[model samples]
Target: MSTTHEVTNQVPPLVGHDVAEDPALLEALRREGAGWAEPELHEVGRLAGSEQAQEWGRVVNENEPVLRTHDRYGNRIDEVEFHPYWHSLMDVAVEHGLHGAPWADSTPGAHVARAAKLFVWGQVEAGHTCPISMTYAVIPTLRANPELAAQYEPLLTAKTYDFGLRVPTSKQGLIAGMSMTEKQGGSDVRANTTRATPAGDGTYRLVGHKWFTSAPMSDIFATLAQAPGGLTCFLLPRVLPDGTRNRMHIQRLKDKLGNRSNASAELEYDEAVGWRLGEEGEGVKVILRMVNNTRLDCLLGSAAGMRFGAVQAIRHARHRSAFGSVLVEKPLMRNVLADLVVESEAATVVAMRLAGATDRGEEILRRIGLAVSKYWVCKRAPVHAAEALECFGGNGYIEDSGMPRLYREAPLQSIWEGSGNVAALDALRAMARQPETVEAFFTEVERASGADARLDDAIEGLRKELSNLEDMEFRARRVVESMAMVLQGSLLVQHGAPSVADAFCASRFAGDWGVALGTLPSGVDTKAIIERALV
Candidate 1:
């Protein structure tokens, strides 16, 4: 055979570089009082960037989870079968305290540290993080019932990864899932028609169908049903006490757009025994705690995707030759790569700031700021991923390049907790009901005063937009997007490198940007911004 088809001009695999070598993330970690965790953060970062870990991400996605709804004897046995690599990913995540462990830690910056770890590990595979995020989110909601929290909190936060259908209490650790959406009431949990009847002995029997229940293989679930008082939150175990399975029935696993390594099932509860969490008629209030934590994950996940995409594009541009020059050296390609780097840095900055809010117990900011970031950052992920993938030209379009996987996973976080409209409205509602949250939001935004003139102007514009409640409902998306960018600008000005900050403000706030990604105005130090994307 002729050796005529030897591959040339092919970009080498992106491996060995520490994924946690992200300057923005490390700076934010040190700035947020979690500098002590830096050693472990790099450890996780190294593992995440290893060729083995990257292969794990690829294998699991290519081999999607399969639903095993019955046994050979035709008995109904609800289960999801995943590739063994799924367990490997989940094992590292739990051991690193990226799941529920941070809630149990007494350290000042425990949550911030965990946030950094999750950001690093999630780049390995985003799908498995669904369960990890749910486990972390459920711990806070479980506290609504002290007794329930006492029983399961230990297992939820345990480092051991116990994967099975055994009784949750018997396991050394447990993974948690959220089963809230119904066929009819997607985000409107109050409209859920699932009914729950008190079973005389401190338990309730639930009867309903959940349209989307992710991580169905997990042992425990935080679900919502209509109690007699009103819609209420409940904790349902896949395996009940005395080694018996609950009445929870798996209807079928959903065929989703992405996140294939994770299982999302349509489920039915036929008088499933569950214990009520919090008071009756307060399900929405109780479950919102979990939603808040998970929304933070949504922001972090989006930021990670951006970082992954930017780094990949830059890595490709550095080595690949195009039009008689390397892509990174080309003027237009340099601008585009720098733009992606700036966006990724901005996202990491805001994400760490929000995680810092959680660590410091800044409830007001976490409540409102989270909604705004969830609305804007998650929405930006898909567009950012698309631009990053295009940097590789036709190579990025193919599945083997792994750019397609990043592109596929980009849009998931936006639709996970609440879609675009739901998130925007939530922020507006928070501002109307809890006025202090608005004060908290602005207070945080004002910290970067005198840092960037365009940011200052944008803040004033946002204030004017929020001042008028007239037609606010119609302008909810507009208001939230403005708030999101202003907050990102403020954080970048205060915490990010001057090059990243200057480029971000120039392109994002000064109106110098265009509809596409590479449209950064000239003189924006593209080389400095692009350099930060490398190890």
Candidate 2:
């Protein structure tokens, strides 16, 4: 394999190197890593057997004849006109849309949906990084400047292709919304000082700089600016209303850690024509809703990348023996690999459930679920990938080994699309508002599991513990823990693909406990206790 990808100038995004070697620290890491355990292959077999899934798989595989030739980045040779793999994803996306892609497939929770989302992300990871998915952002941004909407109306239909006008809304085009992360501001759209002024009849002049614009060439952008009421979303077309120059300038492409295939750039929008997305102050709200897809996308993409890294590590460890034995045969390595596989599955479950809920139009549930899943899995990804990389010994440290790309990319998952801290805060706030929403959320979770009696006992016990706590910090922590439990248990029950009886049982179990738990105090500890009981 080629080692052409550079690593310098790009600091590894993880904090504290070699922390895994510390005995006390390693134990905690080990414990956290074990949360995602290897389940029976049967859990995944349903997806493998799903006719829709199999068909999508065939789409990817059929294109493999072409895909194999390119690097993970979609950099093709001079002779190659177009990578057929692009369309492979479109088929799956349309299929997913038709079959309720991520949510309604009955393949067990959200893993399949996450798998689909990640599949799209991998293409972006391979080389399609543009934050153009901000199509939702345009609605609010254009609300204030609807006059220019006609110019970019074609871009809204997802038919964008080739980075210019008459763009086909190909699978690759969905990446357009990634442009928000310029040097100016990403999640903190309020911080962006990028200015836009009216240039007479409905045309506005734009002036500012941004860093980390994922796809500079995407057809549309869900970018931000300081409008009269507050920060807002804007719809900027790559071309003018008359198909002339739009005046949005690209400064330079950024050199990134991973996801190199999608280039990041410093951008300068100079006297660029502009259209707004929603009402003035509504820009922030609209952008958040629009880019929520990217947040979920980030969560699943990073998780899938972690999964790919683990499989590679396992394959390498199995083939490359040390101490005169295959790595799998060693007790220590076996333990490591076992934990890695299961946790990856667990992460998939968390990510997919959120995707399914969102796909099903369960807005509030989707918001909380996606936020929680993104926070947990994005943070968890590197820990597993790093361990899997360690199994490669010295090979893991080298770019040729492929572990480093994942390691580098892992940190970005948490940082992008609102940091983990932001997501956690948002989640707690949401729970506080609809205290019952959390209960309803968990009820759905419990119903999926058919009443794990121990879980009920554990939650009841935790309720007592939480009821004793008057401290706000402790209460806050408990809320997170409770949410985590519902998320995990709900996903396992709903999507676990157990026998019909088992599914029925899990549902009943979850449904009863969910209602019971909701009736109790907010400071519940059932999930933590249940987790402890399992240990």
Candidate 3:
């Protein structure tokens, strides 16, 4: 006997929908004063949600980059060959100004607008954003050396993206990468043994091995090597001014668990030519600018992951039915979906708020705020992905469901730029070194203090925690988490719906929830929150 299976209750393809059209994101953008960029964001959202974009994401991952160490003639030419889809994605991102739009256009709310575009584009493919982010971040570091900035800034900030290895002068545009980590020093750049010997004309010959050099095919890179003065930042170009390739050799490509579409290489600089970016012994200070910008991107990327997962899960629940009722109508399922919705919105608000601070030049608030948001938002992503996946039952576990990709991508943001411990410690350091930062952070959070009693109480507790300095390092994570919760609650109270803010405060601040999801108290409007999250 032969049996035939019929497809009945499966959800249809979620295509032709604009991710930028998400109500929570639009609301946040408006709150941040970036609503002027809405039409462009809507276009990006349409592309991100299109069927072609989805296929490109899948195909790029399926066809991982190929490392070509040399040609058949045996010349030393190190290159990475990517699938055409990867270049297509890069083209779209560059054309849309995802690489350096904010830096190029210094209009009001430029950073916030760029953040929104990145949040939308990241939902389609994340790997290609690595080079784009590095290119965007290198601007501030490059500005430290005006000569280098004059030489490279135009190329980096150009609207076009010229792919493949080529001379910077010959291309219409350029991208950049970074080589920071060594085999011995993972996050400690001071421990690096790369030696830089002075060459003529303020240049140096750097001989070192970098363990992780992402987007190795880029036209230029910002790296560090020890000089006579101390550890210093250097700008290394792939092609020399004489129209020859530099001595940078690709040893091998890393086999990462995710982000397979982008190539990360272990490289050796055999006396590679490098130009000093800042005064000697100031590499840490100079690189910190780039690191902080990348850290913000990490926060945005994680929030985008949460939005993607929630949308997918909610779409499935709304369509799938069991026990004679649609899954979304089920009481327990509504609670779970609402929990996911609240988390996503909290992340969105905090990320946008940080971007707004950047635009307003609130340096003190940005310092501590970045660390807090980076720690909490990235830490929450893995759990968010897991819960969203569970909402799809067996189908989510399958590769075709797209949930596994999101789950694999969730933990990366926490590990990248800086891990949770690193961010938490940075927060503590900010408080110790610049006590004014704490006051600034509180001032920002206090904007919504009177709106909710529970949030006010949480803010008071956080203040008390800040007063005690003993054992501060050990309790750093807890304190940061509290700061994050209070800040998120404050934003929701100020900009979000009354029901959303009430739900967040009751569960996150007032302790009306449980460890597991689907435990919001009975009177909360779970249905409304879930409906808003459904894209």
Single out the weakest 10-residue window by summed lDDT for candidate 3: 1-10
lDDT of 2: 0.50
* Regions of model 2 farther than 4 Å from truth: 1-117, 120-160, 164-175, 181-186, 433-436, 448-454, 457-482, 497-535
- Top-lDDT structure, candidate number: 1
Whichever of 1 and 3 has more TM-score, that candidate is 1
Local accuracy by lDDT, each model: 0.92, 0.50, 0.90
What tens digits encode model 1's per-residue C-alpha lDDT throughout 15-42? Answer: 8878899889999999998999999999
Error of 3 at 109 (Å): 1.1
For every model shown, what is its TM-score relative to the native structure? 0.99, 0.66, 0.98
At residue 433, what lDDT does model 3 achieve? 92
Candidate 2 residue 331 Cα shift, in angstroms, is 2.1
Per-residue lDDT of 97 in model 3: 82
Candidate 1 pairs with clashing backbones: none
By lDDT, the better pick of 2 and 3 is 3
- Candidate 2 lDDT by residue in tens digits, 83-120: 34434433333323311122223443333333343333
lDDT for model 3: 0.90
Q: How many steric clashes between backbone atoms does each model show?
A: 0, 59, 0
